[model samples]
Target chain A: SQTIHQWPATLVQPVGSPLSLECTVEGTSNPNLYWYRQAAGRGLQLLFYSVGIGQISSEVPQNLSASRPQDRQFILSSKKLLLSDSGFYLCAWSRGNTNTEAFFGQGTRLTVV
Target chain B: AQTVTQSQPEMSVQEAETVTLSCTYDTSESDYYLFWYKQPPSRQMILVIRQEAYKQQNATENRFSVNFQKAAKSFSLKISDSQLGDAAMYFCALGETSGSRLTFGEGTQLTVNP
Candidate 1:
């Protein structure tokens, strides 16, 4: 079975602080990875997606960035977090080159205080 | 770009009743995939059902089914004999044939009254 792990599950960071959210997948290799953010009472917005290590596509221009350090390891980072950066972040993966449904992680709820 | 729309922001159903949540999408690509995802208070996304645009027959899974209208570009989810546990935020998403990423719609919050 394939599973995704994301942490720290919940976070509270001060404005202008650095931020890093990690997501890793187990039981799969070379899967397509994605990062999405959902604002309060709003729909999800695609942040970044990676087909392989070091290959990233940004869907929106914002105050954040994503990196794939390993085949299954994806990191979302920001040099200086802003108040508008707070939201629910989700990590998802799908089978490479297949039109399969995506499996999502537990999601991180970050509150910028 | 592909976009999905869920007109209803919230819907409620009594226990054991059937309720259909509506979803419509616009896409330029002929071949694609549509999906319904459930997000409980825990906020973990669970795939409820999926339909391939090339398939003509509607897809069903036990109590959950999808009414796939490819020509109309509409895909709606029907929940029969709804349960209290079914209460969650339902999201409709669209995926391209390349299978890179998904475009989600504004979610519909389903409330099941016990």
Candidate 2:
């Protein structure tokens, strides 16, 4: 069975600080990874998705960026965080095939103060 | 671009009763997929059911089932004998045939009353 691990489970960051969230998947190779953010009382918003290493696609333009450094490792980073950047971030992985469903991690809750 | 809609912001059902959550989607592509995801208080997104565009039969998983109307572009979920554990935020999602990304609706919060 495949599992996705995301950390830190929760974080409190001051405004204008940098941000880094990591997601790693075990037991799967060459999986499609995605980054999503959900604001309080809002729906999930797609931030970025990577089909392979070094390939990232941005769905919405914002301060956050995503990178796939390794086949099973994906990182979401920001040089400087904004107050609006605070939300619950989720990492998901899916088999490259079309019929496979996406599996989600526990998610990281970031509070920017 | 494909879009998903869940008009019901919230719904309530009595325990052991049946409740249906409505979902509608707009897509130009004839071949696509529709999914219902459950987000409990724990905030983990779990796949409840999925329907393929080409399939006419609805998808069912234990107590959960989907009503897939390809021509009407409507996909609804029916929970039979609802349980307290069924209370959660349900989201309707649409995924295109060519992309891995899924477009989700605003979600409907379902509460099971005793």
For every model in order, the fraction of real contacts preserved is 0.83, 0.37
For every prediction, compared with the true complex, DockQ reads 0.83, 0.65
Computed on alpha carbons, the lDDT of every model, listed in order, comes to 0.95, 0.92
Model 2 residue B69 CA deviation in Å: 0.7
Off by more than 4 A, model 2 = none
Per-residue lDDT of B41 in model 1: 89
Of all true interface contacts, what fraction is found in model 1? 0.83
TM-score, one value per model: 0.98, 0.98
Candidate 2: tens digits of C-alpha lDDT, residues B9-68: 999999999999999999998888888999999899999988889989999999999999
lDDT of 1 by residue, B25-98 (tens): 99999899999999998898999999999999999999999999888899999999999999999999999986
Please report the interface RMSD of model 1 to 1 decimal: 1.0
